[model samples]
Target: MLILAATPIGQAADASRRLAEVLASADVVAAEDTRRLKRLAAELGVEVGGRIVSYFEGNEERRTPELAAMLVEGQTVVLVTDAGMPSVSDPGYRLVVAAIEADVAVTAIPGPSAVLTALAVSGLPVDRFCFEGFLPRKSGERMRALTELVAERRTMVFFESPHRTEVSLRAMAEVLGEDRSAAVCRELTKTYEEVARGGLGELVEWAAGQEQGVRGEVTIVVGGAPSDSRTYAPEDLRELVAARQSDGLSRKDAIEQVAGETGTRRKDVYDAAHS
Candidate 1:
C-alpha cells in the first residue's frame, strides 16, 4: 500500500492524527527532505519507526522505483513532502504513478493545503477555480502564459516567489486589467501570516511600497474574468496593448495579449496600435 500524507504548511499542530500514526509505523517512509521530516516527527512527538529515505525532485526519478519496489514487496510506504500533501507542486506524482502501475493500493491523509487555504480566504468566488502552481519566471514567458488565461472565467490560484511578487502583480495588472480583484497571501498559517486583498493595480502598488518588500511563501488568487464577453473599442485595445508593452512585452506579444483578452482580431489590434 502507498500512503500520501499531508504535512502542515506552517503550523506543526495542523498535522493530522493519521499522519502521526502513519509516520510512526510505515514500513518505508519517503520524504522530500529527510531532515525536515525528522524535525516534523520530533515536533509531533512521534518517533518514526520506519526506514526513512530521501525522495525529492532532485532524486524522485531515481528513488521512485526503489520505493515502489518496497510496495511490491508488500511493505507499507508513506510519502510526504516538506509541507502540504505529497505531489502537489511537489515530488510525489511520479511515485504515485509508479505505485498505481505496480498495482499498489494508494490513499491519502487529508490535511492542510496552501492552495485551498488561500482560495478559501481569498474572498473570491470558490464555486469554481483552478490552481496554476507557479508562473513562468521570465517577463516574456510570464506575459504569454497570463495572456492565455485572460479569458478564463474560473478563479485562478498561483504560487509565487516573494521576490517576484511585486513584478508579477504589476504584470497581472497590465494584462488581466488593473481593476481585476486579487489577494496576496503570505506566510499562510505562520507567525507573519497576511492576506492583502484588492484589485491587481492596488496589489502592485502595495507590493511595491513594502519597505521590507513582500516576504515569505506567497499564494496569489485572482478573481475570474467576467463571464460575458464585453466588446472593446479599437482605441481601448490599443491602450491595452500599450500597457503590456510598457510592462516589457514586445509589440507583437502585446498585440496578441490585447487581441486575446478583448476577442479582437490580431490585424485589428495592430491597426489600432499604429493608427
Candidate 2:
C-alpha cells in the first residue's frame, strides 16, 4: 500500500489524526525534507517506526521505483512533502504513478493546503476558480503564459517563490492588465500570514517598493475578466478595423468586422478611427 499524507501548511495542531497514525506506523516514510518531517513527527508526538528516506525533486526519479518495490513487497510506504498534499507541484507524483502502475493500493491522509488557504481568504469571487500551480521562472516565458490567460473567466490561483513574487505579479499586471483585481497571500495559515488585495498594478507597486524582501511561500489569486465588455482598448479596436479594411472590406463592412472581431460597438470603432 502507498499512503500519500498531507501535513499542515502552518499550524502544527492542524495535523490530521490519520497523518499522525500513518507517520507512526508506516514501514517506510519518504519525505521531501527529512528535517521538516522529523519536526512534524515531533510536533505530533509520534515516534516514526519506519525507515526514513529522502524523496525530493533530486532523487524522485531514482527513489520512486525503489519505493514502489517496497509497496509491491507489501510494505506500507508513506509519502510526504514539505507542505500541502503530495503530488501537487510536490515530489510524490512520480511515486504515486509508479504505485498505481504496479497495482498497489494508494490513498491520501488529507490535511491543509496553501492553495485552498489562500483562496478562502482571497477577497475575489471564488464561486469558480482554477489552480495554476507555478509560472515559468524566466520572465519572457512567464509573460507568455499570462498572455494566454487574459480571457480566462475563472479566478486563477498560483503558487510562487517569495523571491520571485514581485516579478511575477508585475508580469501578470502587464499581461492581464494593471487594473485587474488580485490578492497576494503570504505565509498562509502561519502566524505571519498576510493577504494583500488590490488591482494587479497596485500589488505590483507595493511588492516592488517593499524595503524588506518577502519571506515564505506565496499564493496569488487574480479575479477573472468581467463577464461583459472584454476590456478591449480603442487602439486594439482600431487595429482590428484596419486589418479588416485591408482585407477588402468596405468602411461599413470594416466597422462591422472590427465590432465582430473585438466585441466592441461599431460606433466606438468609428469614433476611435475619426478621433
- Winning candidate number (TM-score): 1
Worst 10 residues of 1 by lDDT: 226-235
Q: Write the per-residue lDDT of candidate 1 for residues 1-275, one digit (tens) a residue.
A: 99999999999999989999999999989998999999999999999998999998889999999998999999999999988988999999998999999989999999999999999999999999999989999987897889878988899999999999999999999889999999999999999999999999999999999999999999999999987657778888889989989988789988888877876778999999988
List where candidate 1 sits over 4 angstroms from the true fold: 230-259, 263-275
Relative to the unseen true structure, what is the C-alpha lDDT of residue 159 in candidate 1, on a scale of 0 to 100? Answer: 94
TM-score of 1: 0.87
lDDT of each: 0.93, 0.87
Show model 2 residue runs off by greater than 4 Å. Answer: 229-275
State which candidate has the highest lDDT: 1
